[model samples]
Target: MRNFLVSSLILGSSLVALNTNAAGTDSTTFQVKITVNESCKFTNAQDVNFDAIDRSTGKQNTATGQLDITCTLGTPYKIALNGNGKMSNASNSGSTIAYNLFQDAQYSQAWDKSNTLANTGSGNSQALTVYAKLTGENNVEAGNYLDTVTATVTY
Candidate 1:
């Protein structure tokens, strides 16, 4: 009976040791991360159309148009116009009408490739206005004059 009791006590002590070691824990750490890139695009662009002008009136013709742009937040961009600053006659290529594009209503700042409009993006669609004026000339041909202006956004 004494030997049996000692054996039982040793088994109980081994079980307790195993339970204590099982309760302890160890761990290692890892990382989570991401990367974002800058981007920009043109949402919309409207044509600038001037009202029919009667050359005999001898007055400058004016018009306004809009451009919409969307870009990543806090991105800096430049808007430029790529036109020759002249409207060629569709019927007669030799004849041309002189015109100019402005960034303001008062036609003070020129909006062209050389003179670009700089702005920052708000992560939403932004509307920009293009102001244009046709120089009044007494000898302009009596017909429909047209011009194509391309708007470019540089980030």
Candidate 2:
């Protein structure tokens, strides 16, 4: 009887150990990390130069400015554009100095309202994505092309 009991105890202990190890091995951990990395490469075809020219006036307006960004490879990014008239000595009136800013001439891609959510955000640097294919074309005009592009930011 003593011998049988001892053997049964050993077998039971061995079985419990095997089950515990198996369970532990099959168990897995799922983790997600949200870290935003911004790699910006802005390329504005219009090289703006604020030249205060001397004309018939004291304050000569010499602002032919443009802004663009080219950044293509990263996690999916969101894009957005700054408001118009942000450059005209911003004041209480909430207006712009430039004439055609924040107009339709600034966008390269126009996604549907639902589809556009991917490239829009409420943050600085405003999500300007770098497309892998378009970046290689080098088709960006050499001269001063007036456009107001929204930035893209991806994860």
The best candidate by TM-score is 1
Model 2 Cα lDDT, one tens digit per residue, 1-155: 99999999999999999998888445678999886655545454353344432233334233333435444444344444432322332232332233222212333443322234243223333322222111112222223322243534343
- Give the alpha-carbon lDDT of every model: 0.87, 0.38
- Model 1 Cα lDDT, one tens digit per residue, 1-155: 99999999999999999999889788999999887677789999888998877767777889999999998899999999989788888898667787899999999999999999999999999999999998646366777777888899899
Q: What TM-score fits each model?
A: 0.79, 0.23
For candidate 2, the lDDT comes to 0.38
Clashes of each: 0, 17
The candidate that wins on lDDT is: 1
